[model samples]
Target: MSFEHEKQVCNLFHNSMEIIGRRWTGAILVSLMDGPKRFNEFHNMIPEISSRLLTERLKEIEDYGLVTRTVLSDRPIQVIYALTEKGAELQPILQLIGNWAARWDSKPNIEENTTEKVLNI
Candidate 1:
């Protein structure tokens, strides 16, 4: 490929990595791959993340036009978050990554290891 085409590809990959590489961002996006979710649902899906961090990541993704936030007019005023078309496009890519991890990741049980270490069990 020409140098200019290579540069453009590099830039596109970098920008995508910048968004997905943020802590908890990938997990958040993966959680939403099934459908829309409420704030608490995210917490349930990714229990390791704090509430404030989840809020921040959600706002950041929303700003990037990857997610759409809608406030429901219910009595308690619920808020729902869903992937936009741009974000939905990531589902297959994320699935491919998951497949790769399953096949090659050396520490697939890292979370279990960490928990065992923490509990000294």
Candidate 2:
């Protein structure tokens, strides 16, 4: 390949990584793959993540136009977060990654892992 093409590919990969490479971002995205969820739901699904960090990552993901935030009308105003068409498009990519990880895992029984159940890998 030409040097210019190689440079463009590298830049594209780096730029995409800048968004997904952040801690907890991938998990957040993967969680939403199933369906829309409230803020508290995200915390519950990803227990290891602190509220502050999840909030930050959610805002960043929303800013990237990957996720949408909706405020619902109810007695206590509810806010729901869901993947945009752009974000939903990442499902196949994430599933592919999950499959790759399963193959490389040293553990003999990946089926028993909670992440496999969560990610539906």
Candidate that scores best on TM-score: 2
lDDT of 1 by residue, 24-44 (tens): 998899888878999999988
What are the runs in model 1 whose C-alpha is more than 4 Å off? 108-121
Q: What is the C-alpha lDDT of each candidate?
A: 0.85, 0.89
Clashes of each: 0, 0
TM-score of 1: 0.84
In candidate 2, which residue pairs get closer than 3 Å at backbone N, Cα or C atoms, i.e. clash?
Answer: none
Local distance difference test, candidate 2: 0.89
In terms of lDDT, model 1 sits at 0.85
